[model samples]
Structures are given as C-alpha cells and as structure tokens.
Target: MNPKMSSPKVGFLYPGYAAEDDYPRLGKMVNPNVDVELIITEFNEDAHTVEALSEMGSNRRIVDGTKHLVGKGVQSVLWTSTSASFVRGLEGIKEQIATLEEQLNVPASTTALAFVRAAKAIGAKRVALAATYPEDVALLFKVLLESFDIEVIQFASKGIITAAEVGTLQKDEVGNLAVENDCPDADALFIPDTALHSAEWIEDLEEAVQKPVLTANQVSFWEALRLTGQFTPQKGLGTLFKQELPKEGELDVIKS
Candidate 1:
C-alpha cells in the first residue's frame, strides 16, 4: 500500500437505508485509517421482486445515483445491494461496473461479484447459502456462484419480500438463520442480504458453525478495500478478511 494511501476513502452506491450503518462501523473497526462514504440510490420499491430489483440496478439508476460520489475522492465505488446486482446476471453486472467507472472514474464492483471474489479469496469452493429473498430470487444467487465455479452445497430461503422487513431482524435472528442453514461439508456459510446486519456478528457466527461466515455487507466492504489495494489482514471480522486475495491473473473472473 502507498504511504499516502494508508487512509483510503471508499464510496458505496447503496440501495436504501437498510443496514447502511454497517459501512461506517466497518470503517472504524478495520483500522481508523479508512473512510466509508455512501450515496443511497433511488428506488421505486424495496420489494425483492424481479421487476423492482431490475429497476434498482438499471445502468441509468446506478450511474445517476453515483453522481454524488464523483467529487468525493473515493478510491473505489461499490454497488452495495447483492440482490439488485445479481438479478441482472453476469453480463448486466459487467455493464453496471463499466458505467460506474465511466461516470465516477474509479474502480467499481457490486456485492454479488464481491461474494464470488471473497469466496475465492478464502478458497471456499463449496458454500451454503442462507438468503432472505424468496426461493426464486435466492436461486439466482446460486447460479451466480456456480458461474464462478463455486458450488452451493446447501440453500435456505426465508421468503422475505422486502428489504425493509429484513432490516428489522435482530442479531439473534440473523445468527440463527446462518447457524441453521450451515452445511457441515461446505467450506463456508454465506448469508446474502445487504439489509441484514452481520458485521458485528461475524466472529460469533463463525464460532457457531465452526466455519467461515460470509455476509453481504461484510464482503462488500472487504471488496472495496481489495479494489483500492488496501487490504490488510484484520482480526475478528471472519475468515474472509484474514485471507489474502489471489494474484492478478489467478482469479480474474471479472476484472476490476
């Protein structure tokens, strides 16, 4: 890391208010040297339906939403909603990142892509998913993971329809979901939903399952650091943060 780059500022184009607090808390916990800025994107509805998610992640919406971060000096920007990004599939996410880079002039990625990279970083070839979306939406994430050659050994869907409702789940509820859905044979347990709070529960959740726990907000923040080349091993955040990313050509599934 560059000497001046010790304190890097990362921007996030988040969808709504659900669990957005995780960013600042993460910045503080990782090291006092990082800055996390967020610009909440506009959306017609918070529902997890395909139509709603498509609108939320549309190129126009993402580009327009990220305009505020242009002059903020953010080293990298991330689309922080997992469901919205994955709903568009791999090609659509590539377009989203391209548009954001064109508009913001910085490295860009999404939470959906972040999960794949984070998993690969930790050598998690097989993972179990515990999603807050309905079965249909949850399956899309499975397909997204499989595209990167990562297997989804077990799947659990909560059938929750809105991000607002998911935001209300307490720590115990979130932890229970992860612990219950974890597969013993899997390398890690993945909880997909930016709305849910898992940043503070990473250690406990990992202890509960005796395996790595990858959560949306947690991986999204870690991905931002990876993009800026500022990743340093951090303790208590779970296995993903402790692992080193593969060299440039090793896992270049989606180029930053």
Candidate 2:
C-alpha cells in the first residue's frame, strides 16, 4: 500500500444531493486518512438542459459554494458536475477552474476535465461515451474529449432530463447502461453524470463490459485525489484508479 498522506483533505462543490454520498464512501474505501468534504451548491433547476446547467455552474454560484470550504484547509477542490462543466466547453471550463482556484486558493478542477485526465492516465485512445444528458448536451462532452485527442467511437445518451431521476438509478440499471453502450474497439467506457451512484458499482460494471468504466462520480473523486498527490491503485474502483497517472507534462490538456 502507498503511504497514506497525513490528514489530507479535499473539498467538492457539488450541485445537489444525488450521489454526493459517494465522496465519503470513496474516502473510507480508498483511503480513510484523507478527508473528503462536500458543500452542496444551490441550483435554480435540476434539469439536464444546457440553460439550467449553465446557470448552475456560473461563477457566482461556484464562489458562493466555496464559502463553506474556505477555512477547511482543503488541499484541492473539484466541481463535481460533468454536464454543468462540459456545457461551457473547454475555454468555459478553464474559466470555471480558474474561478474555483482563485476563490479557494487551491488547485482545482471539474468532473469534465477529470474525464479527460482519467482517459489519458489509462492511455485510452478510443472511448465509448454513455451519457445521461440529452443528445445536444452529451455532444459537448464528446467535443471536450476529442479536444484532448480521445476519440469517441460510440456515443450513447440516455436523454434523462433531471439529476433526480438519474440518482434513483440502481446498480443493475447502471451496469446495463455500461454493458450495452460498450464497444469492442473502444479502450474504455465513459459515463458522465455525477448525480448517479457509480463508485460502488465500478468493479461490476468493468467486469460486465470487460473494460475500463469511467463514471462521473468515480473520476471526480479520483481527480481530487490526483490534485493532492494521494492517488494509489485501489481495488474495485475500475481500471482508472489501478493505472498510474500520466507523468507531469505527458498529457498537458488541462493545467489545473
């Protein structure tokens, strides 16, 4: 086992209560010594539409969310919403990360950037995306990945309109989504949606697809750990965690 960091703490500015519990669960399962703090950001609407997501990820809302994490001594923070971040595109996401780092005075990233980093970490050239957003919204993630040279060989969108509905999904449904959308030519399956609970089902989903399953919540936490330099290969969290992070400057897609 890698030597644990002494009381390392990471904060997350999550949008709502859907799968927020995954962070604490991951802390316990991956490394109990690391503190995982979550501050729920308020949103006007929980819909998966672009307009709603744009509003949810606005700089004001993000800065407001950081109020609770200011004095927590967190090493890094992550905006744990894939659609919300990706909807802004790469430049927009960069602005978002800048806003986060400025407010918290720590290295910060978002779930959208996390997906790209995770894909490069595993050396996945071709990936299959299984998104829970509408086709238009999901296409933004494809664009974001392709910006980093990760090909989207197969894209599948569930067209779910609300985070609340996705939060209600159970393991079986989440597993089937991965298995069904997986492609033989793809190096990994990317599921983008922090509202869904996927940390506990990583092993089963990877087994079913016989490939890496990169879910939103899973990558979000992994990105937070990466920021703190506390990442170690852990069992049952799928191939992303098991692989070594890309060496500094290897994949310079996003400079968080």
Candidate 3:
C-alpha cells in the first residue's frame, strides 16, 4: 500500500509446498522501486509427475491467487512453476495464460514459457539442464523447451523431489550445481526450480561455467517485468538482464 515501496508490482502465483525464499533475495538485486509479491497455492510436493502437476495447476488456486495479487495492486501475473505449466503442454499452458489475463485483465505468463523465451533471447539453441525434479519431470521440461525449438543437449535429474528440500540449498551450492552439470556442447546451463535460489549467485555461476546460466526463479522475474514492459538491465540477477533482445528474440551478438 506504500506508494514509495510499491510501483510496478509483479505478481507471482507460486506453488505452496515449494518455498519462494529466493524472490526476496533477487528483488533486492533488482530496481528497488518495483514490487515483487508472491501468492502461494496448492501443490503436491510428493507428486512429481505430469498428471499430478497438471491437476494441481488446473485447480482454481491459480486464478484465486492471481485475484488476490491483483487486489494487492500487481499489474502482471506469472504462474511461477515449471512442471505445472509444461505438464499441460504448450496449448494448455497458453490457455492457462489466457484464462489468467481474461480474469485479471493483465498480461500473464508461466515459468515454462519464460524459460523458452529467456533461452531464445540469448540465442541458446542447445542447453544443458540441471533440474531439481526427477528425470520424468525433467523430461517434460525438455519436451516443452523443444516445442520452442530449444534443444536440451544434456539433462541431469538431481532426484530432489520435494520443493521444500530444494529450498534448503545455499547460493554457493546452487552455483556449483550449475557449473558442474553444464555439458560441453551446451550453449547455456538451465537450472529450473522455483524452490531453488539461483539469483543470489547467477552472475558467479555464469563466470564459473563460462556460459550463461538460467534459473527458473530468475527468468520468472525477468519475464514478468518484460510482460509489464518494465524490464531493465539490472545487476546480480544474471546475464539475462545484462543484455537486450531483438524483435526476433535473438541477442544482438547472435544472428538468426
């Protein structure tokens, strides 16, 4: 409600069981003027499959959460879960966004789509995945990225099923994971998990791996700002914010 603290609010409908402890850390790294607020919804930490994620994602909790955030003066909404959106596939995820926008009258997006867009922005044709989800869940993400023409050169399932557990990782540990899992042919390394906090050390991770490292939480924030036309190149979040994207989603250094 404090006008000074809250301008350009970005609403995130985050999963319930998964802790969004990282958003605050990343918010501090962004423009202090923008407000990043999260509304938690139902999620099954034990259910790491597509069916489970889809069912949970289909529940009205997303719409309910969006409404709650909009009341808090958020101008945009992002369903901040990768599995939930991709489990439903491309069309289903787009439908989710449509429904969110129709109900809230604000531009909306999901973590899966955000990853795709983020990768495209950097011209990442082949990426390596460092996922906290199981292999099955990670494969679903792979399919989703492939839908956007992004190839997963390598993917490693950390086998960390619960979001609560992934939330326990420190920034250094997260950065090590990004660097360790990066494959030779990958143009970028992707660490997707709202539960995992990567923004705290994304810049360092990029330097360690010698490649762009994208995280779900980071892109979720970036995509939200872009959706609201409030995206600016900021420090600490990662390389994604350090560059600009052309009209075709290619970075200036890359020609499509």
Candidate 4:
C-alpha cells in the first residue's frame, strides 16, 4: 500500500510584485506536514508605492485571487501582500480580511497582519523596521503594527518605489538596513516586503541588529503554520521560526 499523505495545505494570495518570489523559501522553511500553495492576484503596479499596493487589495481583486487556492483544499488562506493591506488604513485592512473569510469560508490572514502575530509570538513590544517601500508606504506599515500595540522604535524606508529594484537588493544591503535602522530600545527588527529576499539573510541580519529579525515572506509563511496548527519549529530560519508558543491556539487571522 502507498504511504498516507498527511500534509496540511495552506494558500497564499500573493501580490504580483512578489510573483513566485517566496514559494521556494517557504518550502524550505516549513515542516513536511505543511504544504504551500500560491494564488497570484491582480496587481498591476510594479512599484511599492502607497497608491500601487493599496489598489491591489481591492475587495474585487483579492476575492478573485482565492478561487484557485480554495479549490486546492487549503485549510487556511493568507493574503500575502504586506504593504498593500495597510497602505490605506486599518479599517480597510479589517474589511479586506472579513471579505476574505466571508468569500473563502476559511481562516484568513495577510502579511501585514502576520507581522503582528510574529511579533506577539516572540513577545516583542518594540520593533524597529527596515523596508524597501517608499517613505509613506513604510509609515503606513508602521501604523498597522502600532495598531497592535507594538512600538515602532526606529524605521528606515529605502524610498525605493519599485519591487523590481527591491528584488535586486544584495544580502549585505539588507543586513546594513537592519543594523542602520535598528534602535537600542527595539526587541526585534522587521523587514517588510516579500519582493525583497530576506530569508537568506535573516540569521545574519538578526546578528547584525542583535535582535530577532522578521521579514515579509518569513512571517507570512509562519502565520500559515499557526493558522493550520502546524506548530513545528523551523531550524535555522531565525528566531521567528523558533518562537515558543503553546502547542495549540486559535488561528491568528483576524478578530474583527
């Protein structure tokens, strides 16, 4: 007889700028019991500007993206757009999540929301930020984090508008961003944007910042694990992966 399959599938409503950017990293980071699936949404903007990412989170667009993943049997779905969800305001972000759960009929989340969960998991009250997003977009992300009662001790937005440019950032550059932007009061440093590859530099960046390092792709993927109840520590992925939480808990998608 063939061996039984026990993997729990999780869906990602990935924005276009992050098109196919995080799957490999996720696959490497998750346990064998968790399966990763992607459903690319309509995001025409190549830039990480507030206007561009915000448009991508329209109810019509995000709902349209989940159909395929829903059919794939995902236990939970995550809107993997970080900046887009918080670009406008928290109320819009709340409605976006409500619409997702209502339409998809499953636990739903977003990278912006996941950052909060990841921070809470590590008990980080104050976090610093480093981002490839423009100054305004980065500030919006900070606002969302602050809504969760997480303090923004320091922030450095690269003011780079395009994901194409962010995608081209070097490891040393991200490491530098982490160190340069981190504040002594911060318990963690967050690097938002799945478009910029941080999975490869997480450990090194954490060492540079001397605090836990959370990134877009890493937190979103880790959120999937929590939503699906796949509570396994991912070795070598950084402190976020090593978060020690209760063995079981409700999915940290959206409360409102």
Best by lDDT: 1
Model 2: lDDT equals: 0.89
Give the lDDT of residue 61 in candidate 3: 61
For candidate 4, the per-residue lDDT at 118 reads 85
**Native-vs-model 4 lDDT?**
0.78
lDDT of 4 by residue, 1-256 (tens): 0125477778888876543556656665655645678877887677776667778888888888876765677878888878888885778878888888888788777888888888878888888888878788888888888877899988888898777677788888877787888898889988998777876677888778778999988888787766775556767679988756643452253556
Better by TM-score, candidate 4 or 2: 2
- Please list the residue runs of candidate 2 whose C-alpha ends up more than 4 Å from where it truly belongs after superposition: 1-4
Q: 114 in model 3: Cα distance from truth in Å?
A: 0.3
* lDDT: worst 10-residue window of model 2: 1-10
- Any residue pairs clashing in model 1, and if so which? none
Per-residue lDDT of candidate 3, residues 1-256 (tens digit):
2334345777888887555866656666776556778778875544667777887688476777766765676788899888888888878887888878877888788888888888878779999999988898899889888867798899898887677788888877887787778998999999988888776687788888988889888899888877776666777766788886547434222121
Candidate 3 lowest-lDDT run of ten = 247-256
Worst lDDT run of 10 residues, candidate 4, spans 246-255
Q: How do the residues 1-256 of candidate 1 rate in per-residue lDDT, one tens digit apiece?
A: 4555568899999998889999888998886457988889998898998899999999888978887887999999999999999999999899988998999899988999999988888899999999999999999999999999999999999999999899999989998998889999999999999999888999999999999999999999998988887887888799988766788866577754
Clashing pairs in 2: none
lDDT of 4 at 164: 68
Cα deviation in Å at residue 237, candidate 1?
Answer: 0.7
TM-score preference between candidates 1 and 3, better one: 1
